[model samples]
Target chain A: MIRMNKFIKLAIATCIIFSHSSNLYARDKLDIKGFLTIAGYHSSNDNLGFQPHLSSSDVGYKGDDEYLTLSKVGLQLNYQLSTQFELVGQIVAQKEVVVDNSDRIKIATLNYSPTSSLLFRIGRFAPRTYLLSDSRLIGYSNNEVIPNHDFYAQLPLSYVNGADLTYNFGLSDGVGTASIFTGRTEVNINATDGNTLNSKFKNLLGFNLEYQTNNWLYRFGYTQSQLANSWEQVDTAIQFLTLVSQDYPSPLVSWTEGKEFVEAYRVKDKWFRYKTLAVQYDNSIWRVRAEIGDLAADSSNIPKNKNAYVSFSRTFDQFTPFLTLSAIKTSSPRTFSKPDEGLVQFLSAQSNQNLAFGLQQVFQFAETSAYNQKSISLGVRYDFALRQDIKLQFERKHVEAIGSNLWVVKDFSKIKDEYVSLIMFSYDRVF
Target chain B: MNIRILIGLICFVFSSVASAEILVIVNKNNPISSMSKQEIIYIYTGRLMAFSNGEQAQPIDLYDGSQEKATFYKITTGKRLSQINSYWAKLSFTGRLKPPLALETQQAAVEYVVNNANAIAYIDEKYLTDDVKVVFRLDS
Candidate 1:
């Protein structure tokens, strides 16, 4: 992998040098573009904080006032090396509410198209995982302040390091495209407890099929990945459970035994699969988009889930009013049974119940994996000037007690099935 | 009867002024004689990069905020200029395709077509010149 990375870097450098040397007088060969979004949002609840996406840092909008959690700027460059080859790069700058936040390259790829119908790209680029995955960061291209959280929050991954091949052909009255991509990526998610958690995805593979007519687009995709490293917090809890179980063994109840529990929730080397189907229709007046996805994993800790969302919008002159309904539900929920009363009493006699208390905390940690929530949003976008628009949106949500995985909370025990309301305003522009 | 005829005449004039005649043009040396509306739409939208004859195609557009530009897009795509811009923004950032080069006026568009055999552009009928060949026409 290290050698391959070095090779890709060298190839990109070579393309840049060749293009500059050959086209010294052709200034039009290199095109530069940029986009910006300045947004502020406020949530109604103070107990929990809201972030635009899970991959973002934990510091976000709280109840006290509006926060700058949704503002970012990006610049993209497309260098045409030749009729058949081009190099593209993009960088985004935004505030990272956590430690070690800095601007990074979002895309750096060398694209080659030998024929009008076929294309190949190598280097780091956004995989065709969803309809808008490739353009997720460009707020000027999106209708809402953010994508539907229920559907997009589950996968915070944006780009991968590898290559992809695409073939598009005219089918009937529309175009049909088939693509295959493979890469490896690392994801950093700030846990609700303020700890930065990292997961490495190895052997990542995915394929997508799309058919787009003048007014409608349909897509189907499948992606599979394997976990390259163990989750730190989960591992620590499992180890603690095993140590306590050794001192207080429960012969009658196997799950209460540490070894059995650890085996059930172990996620290392496990495979995770994602399948999605989406459709979109747009004309001069009305635009509609809908998508559904299913996520499956080998370990119980990574519970199976199904998520869906539908968005509708109508354009009237320079104003567009939109409505979106989204939901995510756990298909498989894990439950933990406490140790028997006799075992609790025995632990109290030996260790003053501190070990028993630790065991209970471990159970609570396991239950956090299952998430459930639903929300509805209404927004309006006004094109006040050319190539610029301002949007105002309001959202109401209902989160099942432990399903607050999407939000940052210090104490999980205080979470309850509650309603959350949020309001956001943003100005988006492109040049 | 005279009053009704006057009102009808005014409506006809207004409608005529609302939608003007637009023409799709290519260089005179280009072998292609004509193109369909769908093919033109595909080229302008960056879906198809080559002509029917497998020759590379370069599409040009009028700069933003022009009346003729807005009307042309409205008649061809049935979409507002802002929406079309947004769509291109998505495609541009994804690195899939780039939008056509935008000239300042129809005269520049015609000049661009005259210089490049593979270039295609749209202009008002008034800008018609002998240096370019008309491949498609949108009548009011």
Candidate 2:
């Protein structure tokens, strides 16, 4: 693995030049250092609205007003490396929203503290989602709108391969401290066959558990995989929803001489199962949050998805004003079908008469993943202190989507009703 | 008890010996006497890592964004920078612990804790002058 990641980057540059000046003249050295937060946001769709090639996407987006690219970039390097041991990192350059985004540099692991309550980490991390993906990019961590126990928006959100184990026990001011965890991930996938679109490969599995205090937090997770939606790198959107459900063009029999039709398809051993319930209410002001979730899938069943979101925040003196209402309900949620015997029955007879003329022209043009979607976000943040370590933030998001992402060629089931706006600026530093 | 009660007790012991600047820091040979602003905000917010006489106190911070860290964390942990940034983003995503080791003043944190030993810090009582000792007095 690139020579053990270059010997863990030369043992983290010899433990940051032997613990930054040898603990200023070691006397039983316990030296430590911190800071690093690079951020960026400009959503129109591509995570936080699903369409990063939809694995039954999340972020209830339907796409419309778009512009303002590279929504993420990151870096958070820490070193204590002793007093038991510590060497954490979060680097990003964009692998897909929130890892350490500003332009991106997503996670660069190497932690093993052995006791403060025990901890261990390996490479490329960010899989402890829920409670806002576990402190989602720390930018003063939370004011809410998106952090209702996110199981990576539904699962398998960040990984290049992983491992994590953390434990903290018995302590309280009001039930706080008694955390537990377990993790494992094995990744590598590629997809294309939505019905013979081509390309395929699948292998993924994930797990999680968490509990926090000094305010409140809890979580549980599970992830499984059989993917190949071209292993998402950017939307092709289920190959544009099977080219609008096989672009119709058939009339009665002789459908390319019967036989067995096929254009693209792949599901095999596919599975997605998830469950979560989250909460947060840290002190020193007013900030509350809530989350609910449930999901189930088998060979192919797009009917059993659930989501929820809630937020409220107010803090001035480094500004923080927020309000959010989010939702997602795609019941019977498991899609990607093709098998009545395939070979090529005239492209499934011009693709089921073009998905029955795009599912009976649903109310006329507007959906593409249409189910039960919703959005209500209003924000404003200004956390400036630019230098003392560095931090300068700016935010503005105004969005509204009731239903979107499901347009079987304007035979709409949803899509249309968006008034999006975004402006996320930041400058975070930590060395 | 005459002559206007001895001129209000000589203006209350001359303004209590002129603005009573109580500076009694310890560990310059340990003799402990005064300390309370909630035990110096629980030894500078490592969440009371001991020392109300239980010893084990080594808290120090300044380089995590400064104005002497909003005036030494608002006169010692009254906290507000979004509650010390949501308590350090939940003590660093629940790995649990971190936030300290920032030196720049208070005479380099009392010469880096009067040269270690359960190291603790504080200064600017007119820079203490004779190498350490002022326990606590952050008001405002």
Q: TM-score (0 to 1) for chain A, all models?
A: 0.85, 0.27
Backbone clashes in each candidate structure, one number apiece?
0, 63
Per-prediction DockQ comes to 0.36, 0.12
Candidate 1 regions exceeding 4 Å error are: A1-27, A97-103, A241-261, A334-355, B1-19
lDDT for each residue of candidate 1 in A1-431, tens digit (9 for 90 to 100): 01223323433343344321211122348887777777767787766677677777534435444434566666788899998999998877665533233226778999999997788999888877888888877776888988788888778886788888988777888878899999987787766666767778899999999998888989999999988888887787666566445544345333345566666677788899999999999886899999999999987667688999999999999999999999998875555565665665565576554656666676766677566899999999997666778899999999888777777775666778878898888877777
C-alpha root-mean-square deviation, candidate 2: 19.0
Residues B1-140 of candidate 2 have per-residue lDDT tens digits of 59888999999988764553423244564445567665555445444454555655566654444454565565555456445755664455433455556676666776776776556665445556565556676654
The most accurate candidate by TM-score is: 1
TM-score per candidate, in order?
0.86, 0.32
lDDT of each: 0.78, 0.45
